[model samples]
Target: MSIAKRLASQTAIYGVSSIVGRVLNTLLVPLYTSRFVAAEYGIVTGLFAYVSFLNVLFTYGMETTYFRFANRPGTDRPELYNRVMTLLLLTSALFTAGLALLARPLMSLLALPPGHERYAVWIAFILGLDAVAAIPFARLRLENKARRFAVIRFANILMNVGLNLFFIVFCPDILSGKYLAGLRPLVEQLYDPSIGVGYVFLSNLAASAFTLVLLAPELLAVRFRLNLEPLRPLLRYAYPIMLMGLAGMVNETLDRILLPRWLPEGFYPGRSNLAAVGIYGACYKISILMNLVIQAFRYAAEPFFFAQSNEKNSPHTFALVLKWFTLCCAMLFVGVSINVELVARVFLQRPEYLEGLSVVPVLLLAQLFLGVYWNLSVWFKLTDKAYYGAYIGVAGAVLTIVLNFLLIPIIGYMGSALATLACYFMMAAICWWLGDRHFPVPYPVARLLIWLLVAVGVVAVSWWAPIGEGWGRYGFHALLTLGFVGLVAAVEGRRLKAL
Candidate 1:
C-alpha cells in the first residue's frame, strides 16, 4: 500500500479507540451535570484542569523522546525502553508520594473547600498512575500493536463508565431504598451523598489503576535496567518538549482554571465562583467532537511522521496530510457550530448550563486552529528544531494568560473562548512562517483559506436564515453539511484517486 493509505489505515484503527472512547466519556457530561449542580460540577472541571498540567510534569516528555530515539539507527530499543520506563516509574512514585503528603496544603492553595482535600489525593494518584503508564502506552504505538492498544484503551473507558454509573447512578438509589435494602447500610458507608463531584475523581482513579494492571504484560516485558549512557541524550532532547508541553497545557486549560477565580466579584451577585465555571465547563464539552478527531490524528500522525522523516517524498506526504486534516477539521467546525444548540439541548441535562452556549462556536474554531498547529508542529519535530516548538507554545501561553486576565472580568467566559481562538491562531500562523524558514512543506494555504471561508459562510447562513424548527431546521443543516462534503470531494477527488 502507499504511505498515505497506510497512514489512513492506522488512523482508522486508532480512531476506533479514541473516537468511541471519547464519545462514551462525553456521555458522562449529562450524567455529571444532571446529578450535580453547577457549583458541584465546577469542582470536577477545575480539578481536572490541574490534572492536565500535572500530567505533563509527571511524564516529562518521555513518550515523544522514546519515539525519537527508538526509531533512530543503531539504537537499542529494549534498553532504551527499559531506561525510560525506569525513570518514569521513579519520578511518578516520588511525585505521587509528595502530592499525597502535601494534599492539604495544595487544596488550600487551590482554594478548595475544607473537606475536599481528598480530591487532591485522588487526583495525585490518578496523574501518577497515568504518567507511569505513558511509556508503556507509547511502546505499543512504537511497536505497531494497534489492536492491543485499542483493546486496553477501550477497557479503561468501559471500566470508568461502569464505575461512574455505579457511583453516580445506582448508589444513590440504593441509599434511598429503591432496591438492595440489605446493602443500603454498606453502600451508605462507602458512598457519600454530600461528596457530589468527588465521585467523578474517584471513578477516574479506579479506572487508571485498573489500566495499570492491564498493562502489566508490557510493563514486565522489559528487563529492569537504569543506564546513564542514554539518560543524558534523552533528557537533553526532552526538556524542551516538556517545556512546550507545559506551555501547551496552559494554552489549552488555563481558561478553565482561571475562570473560576478571575471572574469579577459581584458579576453574578450571590453566585458561587464555581457556578460560572460549571456553566463554561459544560458548554466546552460541545467541542468534544473536534477534540476527539484532533486527538486521534495526533496519535497516528506522530509515529507516522517520524517513520517517514527520512523518505524522499516525506515533505509531500506531510503536505497532503495537512490538507486532508484541514478539510476534516473545517467540516467539524461548520457541523458543530451550526448544530450546537441541538447538541447542547440533548447532551447537557441542566438548562442553567446552556447559558454559555454562545461560546461553543468560538471554542470549536479555536480547536480547529489548534489541530492545524499540531500539523505545522511536525516540521519542527522532524527537523530536530524542537526548541522552536517550545517558543511557539510559550508565545501562545503568554497570550492565553494575558487575554484571559483582561477579558474574563469584562465579558465572562466568552472572553476565555475568544482568548483561546486568538492564541491558537497566532501559534499556527507563527509556526507556518517559521516552518517555511526552516523545513518548508508546500501546505495549500490559499486552498485551506477558501475552505475555511466556505465553512464560515455555511454556519452564518444557518444562523441567520433558519428554515424551521425541530426536524426541519436539522434537515436544512444536514443539507448544508452534505454540500460542504461534496465540495471537498470535488476538489480533492482527483488527487485522492492518484494516491
Candidate 2:
C-alpha cells in the first residue's frame, strides 16, 4: 500500500476513538450550557485550559522519548518501558499529592469560588491519571494496537459522558421533580445540589480514574524495575520536546487562560469576564470539527513519521501529508463557516452562547494552520533538531501572549480568536522557512494557498449575499460547499488518486 493510504487507514481507526468519541463527549455541550450559567461554565473552561498546560508539564514529553528509544537498535524494549513507567508513576504521585496539599491556595489563585477547592483536588487526580496513562497509550500506537487503543479510549469517553448525564442531567431533574420523582429520595443520597457545577469535575475525575483501571492489563504487563541508566539520554531529548509542547499549548490555550485576566470589566455591557469566557469556550466547540481532524491526523502521523524516517522518499511523503491535510481543512473551513449559524443553534443550547459564533471560522482556520505547522515540523523531528521546534514554538507562544494581552482589552474574545489565527499562521510560516533551508520538502505551497483563498472567497460570498432563511438559505450554502468540493476534485483529483 502507498504510505498515504496506510496512514489514512490508521487515521480512520484512530478517528473512531478521537473523532467519534470526542463528538459524543462534545454533544454534552448542550447539557452543560443548559444546566449551568455562562459564568459557571466559564470555570470549567478556564480550569481545563490549565489542565492542558499542566498535563504537558507532568508528562514532560516522555512518551515521544519512549518511542524514540524503544525502537533503537540493540535496545531492550521491556526494560526501557519499565524505566519510563516507573519514572512516570513516581512523578505523577508527587504532582497529584502536591496539588491536593495545596488545593485551597491553587483554588484561590485560579479565582475559583471559595470552598470550590475540591475542584482543584479533582483536577489534580485527573491530571495524574492522564499523565500516568501517556506511555501505555503511546506504546499502543507504536505496536500498531490501534483497535485496543480505540476501544479503551472510546470506553473512557462513554464513561465520562454517561456519568455527566447521570449527574448533570438526570440527577438534577429527579431532584427537581422534573421526572422520576419517586427516585428523588434515592438520588438525594447520591446527588448534592449544593455541589452544583462541581459535578462536572467529579464526572471527569471518575472517568479518568476509570480509564486507569481499564488500562491495568497494560500496566501490569510491565516488569517492575526502576532502572535510571536510560534516564539521561531520554531527558536530554525530552526537555526540548517538553519545551516545545508547553509553548505549543501556550499558543492553543493561553487565550483561555488570559482572556478573563485581560478582558476589561464591563467590556460586554452586561457580561462579566467569566461570562465572556464561557461564551468563547462554547463557540470554540464549533471549531471542534477541525480540531477533531487535526487530532486524528496527529495520532496517526507521529508514529508513521517515525517509522518512515529512514525511507528515501520521506521528505516527499511529508509534503504530501501537508498538501492533503491543508486541502481537507480548507474544504472543512468553507463548509462549516458558511453554515455556522445553524451549527451554533444546534449545539450551543442558549442564545447567549451564540454571540461568539463569529470566532468559529477563525478558530477553525487557526486549527488548520496549526495542523500545517505540525506537518512542517517533521523536518526538525526527523533530523533530531528538536530544539529548533522549541524555538519555533516559543516564538509562536510569545506572539500568542502578546496578541492576547493587546487584543482582549480592545475587542473582547474576538481579539483572542484573531491572536490564535495569527499565532499559528506565523508558526507555520516560520517552520516552513526553516524546513526549506535545513531539510527541504516539495510541498505544493502555491496550490495549497490557492485552495485556502478560494475557500475564504466562497465563505465571503455566503456572508455578503445571504439567500434569506429556511431551506433556500441552507440549499444555497450547501451548493456553495459542493462547488468548493468540485473545484478541489477538478484541480487535485489526478494527484489524489495517485496517492
Candidate 3:
C-alpha cells in the first residue's frame, strides 16, 4: 500500500477509537458540568491535570525508548521487549506501592476535603494500572496490530463510559428512595448518596482494571525471565527522553497544577479546583482532533522511521511525512476553528461553563503547535541527539513556568492557554532550526506556510460571516470546509494523487 493510504488506514482505525472515545468522554462533560457546579468540576479537572503529569512519570519515557531500540538493526525483538516490560513492571509496582503508602499526605497536600482522601487513592490506582498496561499497548503499535489496538482502545473507552453512566447517572436514582422506594432500606445500606465527584474517580479505577482484563493475551505473554544486561544502552537512550517527557508534561499541565497557588482567592472559593479544571478541560477536549491525529502519526511514524533508517533518501522520506502531517493538521485547525461554536456546546452544557469559550481557540492553536513540535522532534531522535530535545523542552518548560506564574494570576484560565501556545511554538521552531543543521530534511517549508496561511484566511472569513442563526453556522462552516478542500486540491492535488 502507498504510504499515505497506509497512514490513512491507520489514522482511520486509530481515529475510530480516539475520536469516538473523545466524543463519548465529551458526553460526560455536559453531564458533569450540568450536574456539578463549576468548583466541583474544577477539582476533577485539577486532579486529572496532575494525572496527565503522573502518567509520564509512570511510563518514564519507556514507550519511545522501546521503539528506538526495538527498531535498531540486529536487536533481538523478544529480548528488547522483555527488558522494557520488566523495567516497566518494576516501576509500575513501585509507583502503586508508593502511592498506596503516601496517598493520605498527597491528598492533604492537594487540599482535598477530609472525606475525599479516597479520591486520590483511586486516581493513583487508575494511573498505576494504565502505567502497567503501557508496554503491552506500545507492543501492539510496534507489531502493527492496529486492529487489536483499536479494539482494545475502543473497548476500554466504552467500558469507562458504561461504568460512568452506572455510577453518575443510574446509581443515584437506583439507590435513592425515589426509583427504588420499595427497597429504600437495602439501597440506602449499599449506596452513599453524598459521594459526589469521588465516584467519578472510583468508576474510572474499576474501568481501568476492566480494560486490563481484555489485554489477557498481552498480560499472559509476559515472561518471568528478564534480561538486565541489555538494558544499559536503553537506559542511556531513555534517560534524556524521560527528562524531555517530564518537562514537556510540566509545560502542558503545570498551569493547572499551580493555578490554585497563583490565585489569591481561588477561581471559585469553597469549591474544588477540579470544577474550574473541568471547564478548562472540557473546553480543552474540543481541540483533541489535532492531538488524536498527532498521536496516531507518532504510533506509526516512530517505529516506521527507525526501521527505515538505512533506506535510500531516508531524511527526505521523513521530510515528506512531516510535510503531510503539517498539511493535514492545518486542515484540522481550520475545520475545528470554523465549527468551534458547535463543538464548544458539546461540553458546555451549563451556561456558566460557557465563560471558558474564549480560551478554546487559544488552546486549539497550542495543541496544533504541540503536534508540529512532535513532528519536528523526529530529527533529534533519528540522529540520537536527544539531548537537544531535552534542551528544547526545558526552554518550553521555562516559558511555561514564567508565563503561567505571571499571567495566570492576571488573566486566569486564558493565561494558561496562552502559555501552552507560546511554549509549543518555541519548541517547534527551535527543534526545526537546530535540527536542520545536524540532519537536514528538505521539508516543503514554503508550501507548508502557504497551507497555514490559507487556513488562517478561511478561519478569518468564517469568523466574520454570520451566515445567519441556528443551523446556518454549520452551513457556513461546511462552505468554509469546501473552500479549504478546493484550495488544497488546487495547490497540492497532484502531490496527493502521486501518493
Tens-digit lDDT string for candidate 2 (15-123): 9999999999889898889887889889889888888999998999898889888767798987888888989999999999998898888766557778898888899
Off by over 4 Å in 2: none
- Compute the lDDT for candidate 3: 0.79
> What ranking of all candidate models by lDDT puts the best one first?
2, 1, 3
Model 3: how far is 308 from its true place, Å?
2.2
lDDT of 3 by residue, 170-249 (tens): 77777654576676566567667688888788778877897789888888887765666777888888888988998898
What TM-score would you give candidate 3 relative to the actual structure? 0.92
- Candidate 2, lDDT over the whole model: 0.89
Best by lDDT: 2
TM-score, model 2 to reference: 0.98
After superposition, the stretches of candidate 1 with alpha carbons farther than 4 Å from their true spots are 179-186, 466-472
Q: Model 2, residue 38: what's the lDDT? A: 88
The model with the greatest TM-score is 2
Off by over 4 Å in 3: 176-190, 266-275, 464-478
Of 1 and 2, the candidate ranking higher by TM-score: 2
